[model samples]
Target: MTQTKKTAKILRCPSCGMLVQPKDEDFPFCSDRCRKIDLGKWAMGVYKISSPVLDPDVLEDLDGLRDGQSRDSDEQ
Candidate 1:
């Protein structure tokens, strides 16, 4: 006879760092309060998703695009 072992996955809440289960109502957050706290942080600009433009070509292209857009808007 052969036997197999089962392992359960573990997850932690992002806001409170509490252990959370996938089956929980909040899933990733420990509670509704914690979930709202995370949302508030995003709404208040406490969290930002940004990266510096490293390539000169990409920067020039972006500036050109912006200038074109502004000219188009002014023409309208």
Candidate 2:
């Protein structure tokens, strides 16, 4: 018996929940625009992966040491 051709796999578009077939050049996205949109999403939250190593709050003490504090100041 012979079987009809079938797509290797089906993938959902990350941008817009559309079904896509493996043979598609943009396998995860139905169109190139959708793929670009997915990339943009990743670009936006890239900060989490590269947050500043030293927070400004940690350096606040340095400024205080340089400038004498006044009694009215909030320093403890």
Question: Scored by CA lDDT, what does every candidate get?
Answer: 0.95, 0.76
How well is each residue in 1-76 modelled by candidate 2, as lDDT tens digits?
A: 9999976655688789899886888876899999888788788974356665386776677666656565337576
lDDT of 1: 0.95
Error of 2 at 75 (Å): 21
Residue pairs with backbone overlap in model 1 = none
lDDT of 1 by residue, 1-76 (tens): 8998888877899998999999899878999999999999999999999999989999999999999999999999
> Model 1: how far is 17 from its true place, Å?
0.6
Give TM-scores for every candidate, taking all chains together and pairing residue i with residue i: 0.63, 0.46
**42, model 2: CA deviation in Å?**
0.8
**Candidate no. 2 TM-score:** 0.46
